[model samples]
Target: MSGLIGRLRGRGRPPFAALAAGLGLAALSLSACGGGDAPPANVVATGSAPSYYPADYAQVINASKGEGGTLTIYSNTDQENWAPIFHDFQKKYPWVKKISANNLDSDEVFQRVLSEQATSGSPADLLVSNAAQAWAEFAAKPNALMAYKSPELAKLPKFAQLLPNVYAMSVDPLSAVYNKTLIDQQPDTLQGLADLVAKDQGKYRDKITTRDVKGSFGFTVSHAFTSARPGSWAALQKILPLARPETSSGTQLEKITSGEYVAGFFISAAPAYPVAAKSGGLLKITFLKDGTVVLPRGVGIAAKAPHPATSKLFADFLMSQEGQRAVAEGGLTSYRGDVETRKDRHTYQELVSKVGESNVIFARYAEVPGAEVNAFVSRWNGLLGH
Candidate 1:
């Protein structure tokens, strides 16, 4: 995995004027408009994303004229830490300008990308994001993304695959999260939490938590449910009344930490617990037995990027030691087996071992629209009733 990113929803649209020179913000704006009834075109469509990088793509892109230029980045990387990565990239491609679509969530990022696609504005050349499903279409589906490969990708693990265009950069485990001290004892897996609720219904009733069936956290939960217990989501319907899923993962985490409820879910496996524990927060989690449930981050270049050369350079930079280290500094985990940072490699290994390598659908959202997630969310909303 190249860029196993974090979660956010409808959050990534910045000011149109500030987006980039020459392009209007019409494409970048997030509108809850009607999506195409049919899922996006597949790879066979006129312009499918690159599943296999051409041998000389890097040579050509790196050798291009606009060697020193700035390219817009639609991402969720925190400013405080990402500065170093940008700075390092600048060192490599001093001529290229690097701008981040900060504070924007995954949905907003996708919306902006789509908007750009429609307006014929050069979509952000580099998309450093975590929403695998959103961009899957561009890589394998028709006319979604252009095909181009970078030599850097070859260094990553085979499991970190998200089509050829996208990279599985980082990793996170969907553990059985809980606020510390809330639950008397920490169970070993998600089933433990359910059992806790079943045995001590009074304690967790209405106070328990999970993500709304909207974001990736809940999405991960759904995948896990489907795999472990085919009909578990339906079973969860019985317990929905007790679950207080919030609109956002950040919110879900905050509620559990404040002791408004005892136990809830959180990403990141055992190694990350210390970070949460540093705050002296009441939180903990465990891995399931059967399959490893992990969340890998991925990203790819826009098929119609304005700065083609810059895009390749940027992606290459990301795959480099400097870029990888920069991302690691953001306190995230990557699927790259040989991440540049020493500490992150250890942290990543710890999480995967505990939670298990998660069930990841590379670039499925943008490609296979209704396969697993759409039906799941629809049923979930019916059960949750908003």
Candidate 2:
């Protein structure tokens, strides 16, 4: 993906830039054809009946009709992973001319949305982020998000909803991804991995991969690990010397697939599942038998959304049963218990049953204070000799 994007930008055909340029050229051509004096085109409005809405959901569906306007979303999730959800949404409401989804880093998305809000602007009708700290920061600001309680929240677990507006779109369980061709055998537990690394430290030097703890998502996962186990930092100290640190999971997966690294730890299952499935036995995921961390990706509406009702409808759709099924089909683990996909994959409920509730460590996103993050980063940098 990075290589493709780099090639596109190198060729002076960046996706967003090309889109804007094409729009400008179309207007210019219209004016050149003696249509400059003509009035603007009229938008055709559709009936308030959305195909996916329930009988009692008519009121909200009616409210979601934005008079043929477009809905824009700012998200950290990859566009491919959420493409099905967007396609279904468009099918339900054909009146919405466009649904612009921008994929950016979690920190970039947070900063851009906040800056726009401060300037009385709205670049996105909805925001989805993996960084919990960003969500907390946005919640601190007055009217940063428009609150709306979804009726579907009742069907979801309590942990899925952070507030009336903010909800978990997906919960990704962290696992160990290994290159089967490089490693003789995969570790069944985190302790087994630590022991293997410690025994053959020189053999695996710089051949293992893990997230850089200083990054937004990295801090969230690493802090949760340390908080869950008393000796996690000690284990990390013995392992970090033999591991390469990366900020992005995609890079880690690619490196592992290419045999640059034997294995990667604390990798999110949402993105890893799709990559591993496509690798034809080269990549494999293992949930640590000792315990594993589950990270929730958040979704919420912008306060000054251009299509506020449309944003709410999209959010509701994500939490619906059909949407949850689509999420699982897209290779993301759904939090809803009822969602089950092919290949005997596990839903949140199935995972709990298999791993045991006591073995699943849910990251306390809201309780992680700023001071703890600072201290963790400082220690991590010192340990890595950065």
Candidate 3:
């Protein structure tokens, strides 16, 4: 039971069938690791993963030393946030040097991976992003990623099961963010917020902001609204009159932080934003009636990683309780427990507090999330009037 939840945090379960599916995946990951040879690198798009090779399996375990090469990680969260996570990771494995090669936008990371894999050379050895669903295509290919069960798997709380190879680095929950001084009352539920928006009319018409759905955080809000709406996403169209768009979560965060807007839907990737809010940083947030859409961004290693052993070692550390907690406490969502609200007036309150709780993790559903998200993004791209 203890390993059941955090281990499977991002997994969609409750139905017996879902649990069975999880066991099967775990078994698959285990079987992959048992061999010495790594799986071939073409199974990224198919349902079945490549078989693990004996030599490759041994190599991954030895990679903890960062011997042959380095681990390249990419993510959209600001560098200011990865400090603690990176620091702790380095401290854990001094030999495994992490090359924080590039900080990318959510919209661009996937395309970069595709381009890099197609021409530059190999796909990134490790990827940490809000766009894991985009990876399903790669997963179907043979030996696209190396699967391993790290020792820290026990510290993972519960959500770790859904994504056997991916570790939730931190919590980035999408919530309704408001200016504490400007808003008279915070809406606790969806209908309540809908009424508030409609009543404010002109005041909120262009004042409320969000990232365009073409990106990760933006897609989250779009998905939530669509799910909450009836018959069609058309129900959310009414809000288009009041909605304005940004290319990143940073813009919306700044608007709310500056008092330029009373409320905006925030894709809180950087915990610094929320910490700023709690520390009298002007912004405050709450899950809309449907609850905040939690994205536990994380890393996964490629099976053909030239440095497969090193990649596995790095991946293992990233999932360990220490790695998850360091990032979670730093303000991003934690996969193990609910974020311990700073309940203080301090910037980076979550980080300052050193997270002690585990939060639920969520992911972009592989089958439906990709196509479903594209449809929504295109819809917004063609919003009647931007």
TM-score of each: 0.72, 0.82, 0.69
Q: How does model 1 score by TM-score?
A: 0.72
User: Model 2: residues >4 Å from true position, as ranges?
Assistant: 1-56, 344-346
Candidate 2 backbone collisions, by pair: none
TM-score order of candidates, top first: 2, 1, 3
What digit string (tens of lDDT, one per residue) describes model 3 on residues 171-256?
46555677878777777554565567777676666776766665445555456545544433343454565777765555666676
Which parts of model 3 are misplaced by more than 4 Å? 1-63, 66-69, 154-158, 161-164, 228-238, 269-275, 278-281, 337-363, 367-386
lDDT of each: 0.52, 0.69, 0.51
For model 3, the local distance difference test gives: 0.51
lDDT of 1 at 209: 67
Q: Candidate 2 on 139-236: residue-level lDDT in tens? A: 65688888788777778899888655789888778889999998767986777787888888777888889887767677777778778876777777
| Model 3: lowest-lDDT 10 consecutive positions | 5-14
Backbone clashes under 3 angstroms, per model: 45, 0, 53
Candidate 1 residue-wise lDDT, 36-94, digit = tens: 12322211121111335566554655554354455666665445335445555554444
Clashes of 3: 53
